[model samples]
Target: AQTVTQSQPEMSVQEAETVTLSCTYDTSESDYYLFWYKQPPSRQMILVIRQEAYKQQNATENRFSVNFQKAAKSFSLKISDSQLGDAAMYFCAYRSAKTDKLIFGTGTRLQVFP
Candidate 1:
């Protein structure tokens, strides 16, 4: 079975600094996708960034980016110039190309301290 691990239960970042959330996964499949989803207090899970295993380039979206280390099976999310609005519970997720299901890691709560 595939599993995602988030060692940090909570993280804090200053309003304008960068913060990285670590995630590692155990998967034997060669074809899969990694994602970072943000669930704010509203409880809606929004996609932050996504990376396909076949691509060597890390995925990026505005202030959010992913450091994808395929060989080590590490997918970390880096948020730059953080804002209070970015404070949320971030979940690292994995989806096999063959299935629509998403296997999620225990979430890391991000606190944006002004």
Candidate 2:
């Protein structure tokens, strides 16, 4: 069984600052995918970033970037220049190439202080 773990239940960041949310996973398969999904108050699941198991380079999308450590099975999200809109529930998700279902972490609530 594969699972994603988010040790931090909550995190706070000041506006225009940066914060890193930690995540770890346990999986047996060598080939898989990792994702960070943001669920805003609207409850829509939005893709923040994604990283492939085979890709050594980390993924980045504007303010969002990932620190993917395949050997340690760790994938963390860094939000640079955070804004109030960044405040949301961030879920770390894992998906295998074999399945369409994504297993998600408990999630971390990011609060952006104005």
Candidate 3:
């Protein structure tokens, strides 16, 4: 079984500021993919970044990055230089390589302040 948890229910960040959202997961399987997804008010699920369990390096995309700790089962997302457009519901996800099943967290609502 694979499960993802976003401990923070809501987060606020000022424009041009940086914010980190915490996430953790539990899985008995070894091969899997961890992901961060953002969904704005318009209702679109966008992939922020992804990290493979086997990869030692963390995943990064533009201002979005992840701190993936395999041993601790922690995968947190960091947003640098946040903008008003970045305000959205962020979800942490896990997908198994064998089952190809994707599981999502409850989500954290990010509020961008001026």
Candidate 4:
């Protein structure tokens, strides 16, 4: 059984600043993938970034990056130069290499203040 945990239920950041959302997971499987998905008011799940367990390097996309700690089973998302558009509910998800299912965390609602 794998589970994702986002201790912070909500977060806020000023525009143009940086914010880091924490995420941790418990899993016995060695092969898997971790993802950060952002859901805005539109209710669309957008893929922010992804990291494979076998990859030693963290994944990054533009202002979005991940701190992937495979040994500690921790994956955190960092959003830099935050903008109002970045305000959304971010979910940490896990997908087994053998399965198509994605197990998501409770999600952290990020609010960007002007």
lDDT of 4 by residue, 1-114 (tens): 899999999999999999999999999999999999999999999999999999999999999999999989999999999999999999999999887679999999999999
Judge candidate 1 at residue 46 and give its lDDT.
Answer: 96
Worst 10 residues of 4 by lDDT: 94-103
What lDDT tens digits, residue by residue, belong to model 2 across residues 57-103? 99999999999999899999999999999999999999988876799
| Predicted candidate 3 versus true structure: per-residue lDDT over 1-114, tens digit per residue | 788999999999999999999999999999999999999989989989999999999989999999999999999999999999999999999999999999999999999999
Return the TM-score for each candidate structure: 0.98, 0.98, 0.98, 0.98
Model 1: per-residue lDDT, tens digit, 1-114?
Answer: 899999999999999999999999998999999999999999999999999999999999999999999999999999999999999999999999887579999999999999
Cα lDDT of candidate 2 equals 0.96
lDDT of each: 0.96, 0.96, 0.96, 0.96
Each model's Cα RMSD: 0.6, 0.7, 0.6, 0.6
Model 1 alpha-carbon drift over 4 Å, by segment: none
Q: Residue 24 error for model 2, in Å?
A: 0.3
Regions of model 3 farther than 4 Å from truth = none
Model 4 spans > 4 angstroms off: none
Query: How many backbone collisions does model 3 have?
Result: 0
